[model samples]
Target: MHVEEVFVKARFFRALVVAVSALASSAGFAGEVQVAVAANFTAPVQAIAADFEKDTGNKVVASFGATGQFYAQIKNGAPFEVFLAADDSTPAKLETEGMTVRGSRFTYATGALALWSAKDGYVDSNGDVLKKNEFTHLAIANPKTAPYGLAATQALDKLGLAQAVAPKIVEGQNISQAQQFIATGNAELGFVALSQIYKNGKITSGSAWIVPASLHEPIKQDAVILNKGKDNPVAKQFIDYLKGPKAAAVIKSYGYQL
Candidate 1:
């Protein structure tokens, strides 16, 4: 090869190498973050995680369950990098226990309680079905571990139906299972997160009376980075993405308030 041609090739090769390095650095090596998500926020988190993975070229490994269970798991050193809790208190409790990153906790969504049934027109809009007491069984999460379950009991208490409805109650370990009971006809009707059966400004299927927020305590969903995720950049990115406009739109579509 001619000397001039050799020089030109060397320069071009160096430029190519530099360009590749820059591209790789900008994109980074695709990393994955393990996230523990609350059961009620399942749909919204799945939607948001899809967008997050698409936009950032990262993977979100999410496990959905009740917030209190997740809290216990985290305390026992579950390998979760982030937590999306159904209520603000679990994250706060984790923060206090040094299980999470400091100042990383924030409310992600405000959930609504819903009285839902898989059968069409089975649940009245005003939630008179609870008062009517006509169903063979009613489903609720175990109030001891699920915030939605606590909210359900609170609403029952407010309506003076706690004792009357206690006998026929069937309990699920988590809100998702409680919903499954209704969906699979294991129970005629149940209390579930509004987001579970709601979408695009309405219930997705069956009948639901959106339990008035005034009937129970506000369901403030929160998120935080766990100690396991303290050094993971993707953990912060996921939370930041959730706090952005795109994720907020998805959350709202599922009947959650930001």
Candidate 2:
């Protein structure tokens, strides 16, 4: 009612509005982020994306493929705002090539390799099935592009069966396709990500020999905000969400190490 009281109230309301706007800009994001995710991380990442949308009202559009392919696409100026690579090397390369925001790279997960079969009991715990040579076709992702494929090659070489099984190998463009090959019986068995066959802290179906971590290099998966996403609040928030407790739990449930 008094002039001084009215002036003080108006100033307080303006300050509150400014504070709320700043908070929205910082955390209350509103945009769809375009993400390039590695094929092996498809399931868990989808789950994480769903949680992020539910919690933050930010949408994520993910494209799953080989890390190497994603790297090439990013280098060529693809519109992806985020890169979730199957291996740290690809993201490091992109950083070196200036395709991503500097100092934005971080390891998100460590993946394990698995020798898997769609048929129950087809693959043994110790992977003796490979030594038996009972199967005609085997599937693997493209070693040049997929990190899991490279790990599979290493495992075969370690077992001294690379030369023997070379002829029966069926290569997929990405790990997801390789999984399809085995799941549909096009191949009797295949090398795939442990996450692909694991669920709820155990193998959900079929059988798998989780390749020893010592047999191959560690699959340190990394995530980076691409140059296109440097200014995207939702993109940055998505990366943060992946490192948060909820997303990490989902990732672990799929057998990936964070």
lDDT of 2 by residue, 77-159 (tens): 89999999999999998888888888889999999999999999999999999999879999999999999999999989988
lDDT of 1 by residue, 1-258 (tens): 999999999999999999999999976788989999989988888999999999999989999998888888888889999999888898998888888899899999999999999999999989999999989999999898899999999999999999999999999999999999999999999999999998899889999999999989999988999999999998999989999999989999998988
TM-scores of all predicted structures: 0.90, 0.88
lDDT measured at residue 162 in model 2 versus the true structure, 0 to 100: 97
In order, the Cα lDDT scores of the candidates are: 0.93, 0.93
Which is the leading candidate under TM-score?
A: 1
lDDT of 2 at 135: 94
